[model samples]
Target chain A: MMGLHKKDLNLLLIVMVLALFAPFILNPFPTDSALAQFNAGYPDLMQRFVIFGIFAVGFNILFGLTGYLSFGHAAFLGIGSYSCVWMFKLLSYNVVPGILLSVVMAGIFSVAIGFISLRRSGIYFSILTLAFAQMSFAIAYSVLSNPAFNLTNGETGLQVYASDPQWLQSASAPNAPHLFGLPMRATETLTVGGWDFQFNVGYYMCAIIMILAFYLSIRIFRSPFGLMLRAVKSNQQRMIYTGLNTKPYTLAAFIISGMYAGLAGGLLSAMDPLAGAERMQWTASGEVVLMTILGGAGTLIGPVLGAGFIKYFENIFSKINDNILHQWFSALPDGLEDFLITIVHPFIGKGWHLTLGLMFMMVVIFLPGGLVEGGQRIGAMFKRKPKDTNGGLSAPATPAE
Target chain B: MGILEVKNVNKRFGGLQALGDVNLDIQENTVHAIIGPNGAGKSTLLNCLIGKLEPDTGSVTFDGQPVLGLKPHQINQLGISRVFQTPEIFSDLSVLENVLIPCFAKRDGSFRMNAIGTVGNETDVMSTAEKMLDDVNMLDKKDVLSGALSRGDKRRLEMAMCLVQEPKLLLLDEPTAGMARADTNNTIELLKEIKASRDITMVIIEHDMHVVFSLAQRITVLAQGRPLVEDTPEKIKGHPKVKEAYLGETAA
Candidate 1:
């Protein structure tokens, strides 16, 4: 019975189309253009954008609607990644088992964490989650480090071998694994424009699962369960007196978000075919939080954009160096070039995070709603008269429809 | 059996006895009012009944089942709903969405994990919420943000929210607390109308005598965490103890 608003649906369609064609849009810079330093259209980064987008989207489900700030969501991501790698090592190289294992592991971990953490709310809840995540990280770094060294190859990480069983295909076979016995690889790719997109077989697999995750999140956002979550955020005491159980609702949101994180973790290892304990680090969890906040916490599309934004910056900025900055500024007058180089120097080479941190602070202080809000503002400015009375810059009221 | 029964319920907060040896029985399909001065443990009693505060002793039964120790949502599932003194509807949600939430709870029980179904597409929830809002004369303001509504309209929306749940026993903690006189009268009239149309039991805590006298068939007066008297509205108006504790000696 729940459907997106027509405007929201249109916006979602636009985002989907854009994500699909991001490679082309990002490839606009000439082979040696200065902007090429910022290009993130490559397959590796694009894949990361989607995976982390899943992470942020999941975080938003709990933080945005429920207003519960969790500082330990990275634990679930790390668990997912670890479980996924274990699946690949023990079961098969096929990603399906790995992703499923990740989701299950993350979900079980969340249940235990949520049960204990949900006993407190507000700052306490945040601290509780942080403690749990830190504990997990420490354990993973110590006890699991040895097994992971053997299993995941420790910090060295695990990689698939070419001689490893292609569970999806047998050697000397013309076709990939069949369902039971039927050919499964036939429907893999649908290429266009002479760009050999394999569907990668794996890429399409992740895409289908991402779509499912997106759809599930959308449903939860509109369902009565989501209503209870918002109610819990608004006035928990009132909910209790109104005869509503706030605890279970909060727990459900926590678990759901954890599962999504796990899914993202699984997908990451699947694509890269390795899992390191670093994936479970607190900073990785913080990155998703940043992405969610940067994209707009409550809105569906915000987290995706936030994920893309952060990943894009990471990919592009990491590639730029002092030489690249110098080459661009060399065209200017001597003094101007020196000033320009000074201005841009810190943001290039090893200082990429400095730029990103500054941008994040600006966004938080000025536009807490993230890039989605920024986009909406730009769209509104173009559509309305300059002196429009509505003052469209204010946060869009959540449509009660 | 009474619709709701609380017997010998005792609650203590550290050393302070918030409620001690409290007892009350609310009849079916009647408005029952509890009136007391500030710090008389009126809110504590409400909290104990709804399981927000566990009573150190005694039991609460709704319809024939023990409601003590049950979660709030579990109590709601037993056909009990409450509206807080301050308007508690989701502020960001529209008036309609606020009412629709309780309606969903009534139909779907306490918890639902279905994350794919469209909420607004539920025809029955919309129609029922619409009807409830109409009963409270708030159908016109259904689409407005509940937080933006005037105090009176907000009260109306809260009432509508409770009504949509089809609660057998409605516990309202001062439904007309901060409204202007005109709005107060309107709310009184709305309560009277709802009482007439539905066979719903009510336990209301009120500071305002006019709203209480108009709606409550029975009145319970509390003083210092104990029930001073429980009597018919007429007797309560004349009772010497109630007059001394609440209504004032001159009124008696």
Candidate 2:
């Protein structure tokens, strides 16, 4: 079981099965049906789900384990994306070198940022990270994209120009980002009945990488280092008094999560060879925080769940406009149809954030441990029924529901 | 030479002289007690020894090496472990994990990545932690969250955490500060059993004469941040200076 405990192994297997069959699972609605717009089987959105899943999984290492809330993790992601695009521009369209370079570059920056930011814990640490991320966004937007040194390519974003020297690219090789001869954009469409399922090379790659990242996260959660990180969160005073240094432990978690974000950013560019200054924005960092918290910050599967939840809403919910709303409520009476659309309009389309906000609030209030806790509670409820059935059979005097 | 030596230790917090020219020696394999009333600077002295506070003037050495200016973790690595008046276990973690952390710290020095392998696979550390928990009679509750444990159990778990490291010096700050009689006796018995089984030095700071007299071999009475007397517990019980400072009664 790859050195995993039985419980963790089962969890990993479940994730793997779900990821491998996502195209089918996500596209339950037929293409010709009105609900087809809700199907998230497309390559672009599917790739984002796993990529952000990787980012949140990594963020959980630092924020969840060590209880250090970082508000600047997106800086590393931007650095990763930029490094990836630079590779595509100089080294070839092959994603291997770009992804590897992105991880390394993110690790370096994380070390520098983590070393400074980790000096202060709690809100101070968060503010410091926020400051660093904002600075990076500003620099990437204007400073680095200047004519003299266009590292990030400024507001227009960094992309591979045809005129740029791609030293390792061969004439026969795919012009787009690829692994060997397989282009990332390559996809096979499978039509069964009215459903259209997309099996994209890029999505599969991201999924495989996400699975690996998840496995690594599971290992870290069960490792001595992960225990130490949890100890850092629970009682840093106790940790220090017990002869454990908190500095290197927190810094290591920070660097590790940074590398994960970097890999995610690299994947983002690999899917579409563009690195934008907005990739490093504070809002991007905030989104990962939301994903981790919404999924269950400390749990192994929580971040992935949170990532999928947010990404699904962002993609599907936002795609529903007045036309779609009108189409869905067309069966109702004319007055009621317009009324229903009016009520739903504020929660969809450009107002998708309103829906996400309401859900996030509900999750925070009712399920403090996030979706994982909600699932566990439901599971416990089902388990309680069997035991209660035996007791209920014998207890004739007791009131039965 | 004693295992720990404090010479002319003076610590000032702003205008207040918290510890004024304090000096003492703690020998190996013996329980030493520091007894004083409130504001007698017992906690401050313990903080100084453990590197939580810097003394303005003094040389505190453990095993002939100066511990001044070292961080708490560094001092801990030098074989000194402190048990707080309130147990400081990792509350969010399991009881077993609470004990296992100290074992890792003892083996891995200050920091090691140790990220690839599973904690369950560290059979040696796992066994050591289990044995320590067994020593504290908490083996069955290993899976229980440390936060959910009763206060007495929390203290025992904290003891196990410190003892798993097998430090040269174990400092207890009011080990039975607010315990009921039954819990206090249990702690006393636990400490007695630990003392009988291990070759370790203990320094206890307490206001409770019952716990102090039950465990301490040597007693040092402090008054107004100065060491008034150091003697065997039997003699310390009869010392007139101890009667005056500790008993709150004027002794002629």
By lDDT, the best candidate is 2
Runs in model 2 deviating more than 4 A are A385-401, B247-252
lDDT per residue, candidate 2, B108-203, as tens digits? 998999899899999999999999998888887787778878899999999999999999999999999999999999999999999999999999
Residue B213, candidate 1: Cα error in Å is 2.5
Model 1 chain A TM-score equals 0.86
- lDDT tens digits, residue span A1-401, model 1: 12775755665566666666565665655545556556665566767877887888899899988999999999998888888767655655556677889999999999999999999988999999989998887777666557434444555765555555545444444332222333323333333443323223344445556655665677677777777787777767656655566788899999999999999988888777667777777788788889988888888888888998988888778788778777877888989988988888888667888989999999998887788778877877889645633233222336211
Name the candidate that leads on DockQ. 2
Model 2 error, position B196 (Å): 0.7
lDDT of 1 by residue, B1-252 (tens): 799999998888898887878999989988999998888899999988776778899999888999887877787788887888888877877777778777777777666665666667778888998888887787766766677777777777888888887789898899888878998898888888888888999999999999899899999999878899999999988888987876566765
How far off is residue A54 in model 2, in Å?
A: 0.7
- Kindly provide the TM-score of model 2 when superposed on the true structure, using C-alpha atoms: 0.96
Off by over 4 Å in 1: A1-5, A147-152, A160-169, A172-205, A385-401, B14-17, B246-252
**DockQ by candidate, in order:** 0.39, 0.53
